[model samples]
Target: MAQRLQSISAVTVSGALVIVLLLTLTFGTLGAVAFRADSLSGLSTRDWAAVRFTVVQAFLSALLSVILAIPVARALARRQFWGRSVLVTLLGAPFILPVIVAVLGLLSVFGRNGLLSQALGFAGLEPVSIYGAHGVVLAHVFFNLPLATRLILQGWLAIPAERFRLAASLGFGARDILRHLEWPMLLAVVPGAFMVIFLICTTSFAVALALGGGPKATTIELAIYQAFRFDFNLSKAALLALAQFGLCAIAAVISLWVSIPAGQGAGLDRVVARRDGSRILDFTVLLLVTLFLITPLGVIAVKGLGSVLSLPASTYGAAGRSVCVALASALLTIALTLPLALLAQRVSKLIEGVGYLSIAASPLVIGTGLFILVYRWADPVVLALPITILVNAAMSLPFALRAIAPALAEVERDYGRLSDSLGLTGMARMRLVILPRLRRPLGFGAGLAAALSMGDLGVIALFADPDSATLPLAMYRLMTAYRMDDAHGAALLLLSLSLLLFWVFDRGGRVNADI
Candidate 1:
């Protein structure tokens, strides 16, 4: 009974994803048909500038993320301190956190009147510009560094304990051991991490749109938004969207090629014979990562606290809307993602790859495709909120799959035959047998989906009207209007909401169902 329901849910989830992909592809095909022949002729100097800036920012963001990850990955690999697992889990949160929320936290710390500014004021030093290209880079690093750190750490963990034991037994020096074991792990993970960060930065609209001070800082995604929303230049927006797609598609292909297999055993506990390394190098690495990871957050918390009372009533309303949107998106994302995870588990590897496609594609790209589709059918697009929820759910699919797949696999491996023998088949099996056993993964996936949707500004930016703004979108408006106080308050609220949702969902997932 349970098996039968699982099968039905799995098929339904897979079908939903297929319908979405088809819609997106259909839009892309129409876009190509209408715009491809004329895109070159319509390209402007400003479009060229935006394209160049986008590429440069993404490349630099990727480079910095992977380079900075080296040490944190090393520390995480070598040390097993108190709260280490908690810290590792926290590192993964940024991947799910909305870009706008991170940007808010970043601004509260790094902005002109941010905490840093106040601290530097005492010494008569000016606060650095946290707008334009610089802000985008900082925000990108904040989000990507932790992700790269985790990925590289996974690679380090994959090295067999026997190899480390042999090295220790042979009295291998730190340099020799690193050259043989550490370097290999680093090399394998770095390129793929870089590519992921690069793809993310490439499609960034909120960060660029909010922080981009002028013509100088525009990214391609921002260009598309401006062309469509502000200027009402559909043809040009369509043209730029294609350009954005081409660049992202190439980057995605390269990223997928270099990506390491998403195996279940990678994050599991492993034993490695410990060896002494240069204390100086270890300390330096730890310090750099700590400063990079925690400082901005600290900055935001302090500054946000100072300005919290000054926030406007409208900001509060926006916060409420954001909460509703995040919650709805999270729920929708989990409901949709469950079946996709099951499909990935049950279907051929090739079809499983289709389930993983959301990672390689950005939210802006997906949203663009949807926009084209909607504009075809409706003049004003009445279903913006539902559409935003749907798109956010789809965007959250990769993270949802990553969180759920391993646990599902583990459950299947251990209980497949037992369940079958017990005559567990459809919905009965899922409710009675599978759900109880898979609570942890389900909760984790739910938390991730909620957190990611909370932090997201991509689809919301496209769909939100002035009266229908989510927190992230409202915060962007504040920043652009130079309403620093309001922006700070909203930023703090968004950050708290995202973290709280993540924590609740994560804890919820841990609840036992009496297996």
Candidate 2:
């Protein structure tokens, strides 16, 4: 019965995606027509500025985030200190924190009247503007640093202790030990993390738009948004979207082409010296990085306190809609992803690679494709919230796989032999066994989908109307109008929603023994 339900759910989900793809293709064509020939023409000086600014900002953001993460990650990996788990989990908060929320916090602390400004009050010294190119870089770093730290920490943990032990036994110093084992781990993880951060920065819309302060610092995503929203230049937006897609495609190709060592087959049980010569350095770096990463949230909390009650009823309405949409999307995402995951597991190892491909494709690109499809059928794609849910689910599939694949592997390893011995195969075995065993992964994936959908500004940014806005869209709207207080309030709400959903789903996964 469970297997039958799984099969049915999978079919339904695939069918929904097909419809979504068809709708998006239509929207893309219409957008193309709306943009016209001139929109697709060669770059203007403004375009050149945007292109240059985007590349530099993204490259720097990726580089800085990864570089700053190494020490923090090393500390987390090496020390079994108090509050380690809390710190590790806190790193994940920024992942779900709304861009507007982080921006607001950054502005409150780093802006002219910000806390730091008051601290460094000097005659003839002006306040630092958390706006323009600097602001964009700051926001990107804020968002990506924790993520990079976590990724690199995992890499650091993957190194066998035996390698470190061997080094210690050979009288190798800390520097020598790092050169041999740690450097290899860094080489393997840094590029991949950089690629992830770069891809995120490439499609950055809210951060650029809110912090950009003008035309000078616009990213391609911002340019596209401006063309569509401000100028009503659909052709321009369409052309820019095409360009953005091309660039992302090239980046994705390059990332895959670069050969990096995988984490697999690493020694797991090499005992290394816990006390190292670099302890002081590692502690200081960890302290600094943690403070930097957490400061934005702290500022938000301080600044946002007064504005919570000032939020209008509309904000609450939008929040409700966002919750509903996220919940629906989570369920639908799990429904669709489970079948695909199972199919991949059953067919070939290569099928598993699809998960990573989905990860590399920014949410905005997928949203664009679906938006293009939506326009073919009608005027307001925003009215079709059901379709939005499906798209959100598909978008979350890559992360879902990351969360579930390991558990799925373990389940297969433990149960495969038993199922075969019992003469159980195909639908019967899957229904009676596999689906039940997969409950934990399903819950984890569902929660992740819900949490991600809760905070998404991409698809809704393209399709949202006055009446159709979700929480993130509402928050962006507030920011665009320079309603910092309202935006801050909304950001807090969104952040809470994301974290709560994530916690709920994660707990479900844990109870079910998925991870």
Top-lDDT candidate index: 1
- lDDT by residue for model 2 (181-252), tens: 788778888888888788778877778877884667888877777776677665566666666766676777
RMSD of each: 3.5, 3.8
In terms of lDDT, the poorest run of 10 residues in model 2 is: 21-30
For model 1, residues 353-415, the per-residue Cα lDDT tens digits are 555656555566566666766677774346667777777777776677777777777877888
Which portions of model 2 miss their true places by more than 4 Å? Answer: 1-42, 122-124, 262-271, 354-357, 381-384, 420-431, 512-515
Q: After superposition, how far is residue 60 of candidate 2 from its true place, in Å?
A: 0.6
| Residue 152 lDDT in candidate 2 | 90
As a TM-score, model 2 comes out at: 0.88
How much is 285 displaced in model 2, in angstroms?
1.4
